[model samples]
Target: MGELANCPNCGELFVKGAQTVCQNCFKEEEAKFEIVYDFIKKKKNRTATMNEVSEATEVEKKLIQKWLRQKRIQPGSFPNLTYECERCDTQIYEGRLCLDCAETLQKDLQQTDQPKTLKEREDENKREKVYYNVDKENKWRS
Candidate 1:
């Protein structure tokens, strides 16, 4: 079923579809994509960073980041292009986090998952559980 939604870019009502924005906004974005894509597709501009691409193409950094996240602009083809890590502000070509943050997070998770002491395991086993009797009519008695 289609639902009504407001366009995030222009704040206009539109039928909700696979597109995040309305048709007008989507068309505008396609035009912008062409501009940005053409600017970075040149051999000399293959090494341009995200910031440099945004500046040279006059496109918003957020839009370029969106394109990267959508895989419309592949980082593998452009060595210097990168987006910020989700956990840290460091630039990364792929995944949500850089190597250092991912390793730190993994270490923290491993430390939290250490084996429980014998006493702790015993305490968990000793936790109370209650049982209730039910009448023949299938109703709770207690």
Candidate 2:
């Protein structure tokens, strides 16, 4: 066993072993953990952005990310869990927006299932006019 450290909750001496703190402090921590876990476990709570979790749980985002890295919480179990991009309001699984967003602005480029714009129609007409003019010029020269 390692030397005792002061309990963060009660400032009491706690041995360094399986316990993070003294029994009383451990119990308090356990209770807090359960509260957070339960809040996240609800089906309605399936998807939680980092900001949302921070606002709801009152836990720091950095601390939550740390916990995730440590595997204290299994992200695999939470499929809908996502984080928002600082630049865009895109939902992302890990750090920021989805991989496609990182690569390019696919959402912006996705063609809408609608009619073509006036400019497109005008461009097509111009091409037809040009072809007609070329044929007329050829016939006059011949």
Candidate 3:
């Protein structure tokens, strides 16, 4: 069972499932989203930037940015659509983190994996030494 919590927007008690806001706030956001979506979808507004969309639709820039980050509105179609990277706040068209942050994370993971590779090499060397000793012992016994 989900925990009962006050809506972040309205401060009213609502069974929060897919949305953090109450039903009222959720409906309001939907209306706002539709307005923004409509404005952006128009052929003339296809090249509109984030600021232009927000100004024209009277919708909050952050709200539109949320949609962009969620990929609810694809950057490919919008062309100028962008949102802050979670790590460095660099504007990016797609994904949570920017290319630099992602590359840094990849490098960090590779470094973490290096120790395991070194351990494996050490284990292999030990195995080879053991086999050599065993072969020598067997030859002596023979």
Candidate 4:
């Protein structure tokens, strides 16, 4: 079931459905998308980057990035269309991060997620332990 909410674009109260914005905003966005798509559909603009497309169409760079993330603007169709990597800001045609950043993130997550063995935990505990002994002369020895 849809819920009543304020439109993010116009701040108008509306029933939230497939889009986060209201119907009017959605229509406006659709029109903007058509403008962008039409510009990209031209043979000369097929090699245009996201920045180029945004500048040429007078669209927001962030909005163009969002469309790239959502795959509404297919990068495969345009040879030079690319978005920035979420981590390193490197240009990428697909996903949030480029291959290098993605691999590094995957490796870091894997290292963190790996469970420690009982022997490893016991070894770590042993390394952390310290014993002190007091002799007859009241000298502390470790």
Error of 3 at 63 (Å): 0.9
CA deviation > 4 Å runs, candidate 2: 59-67, 79-142
User: Which residue pairs collide, candidate 1?
Assistant: none
For all candidates in order, the CA lDDT equals 0.91, 0.66, 0.85, 0.89
lDDT of 1 by residue, 81-141 (tens): 8989999899988778899999999999999999999998888887755678988899986
Report the lDDT tens digits of candidate 4 across residue range 19-138: 888998889888999999999999999999888998999988877777888999888899788878999999898889899998999999999999999999999999999999999999
Off by over 4 Å in 3: 116-142
Write one digit per residue (lDDT tens) for candidate 3, span 1-142. 5568898877999887777778898899899999999998999998998889989999998889878877888889999877789899998898789999999999999988775578888998887773323364466321
How would you order the candidates by lDDT, starting with the best? 1, 4, 3, 2
Better of 1 and 4 by lDDT: 1
How displaced is residue 71 in candidate 2, in Å?
2.5
The deviation in Å at residue 86 for candidate 1 is: 1.9
Residue runs of model 1 more than 4 Å from their true location after superposition: 107-118, 124-142
| Maximum-TM-score candidate | 4
TM-score of each: 0.74, 0.46, 0.73, 0.77
Give the winner by lDDT: 1 or 2: 1
| Candidate 3, pairs of clashing residues | none
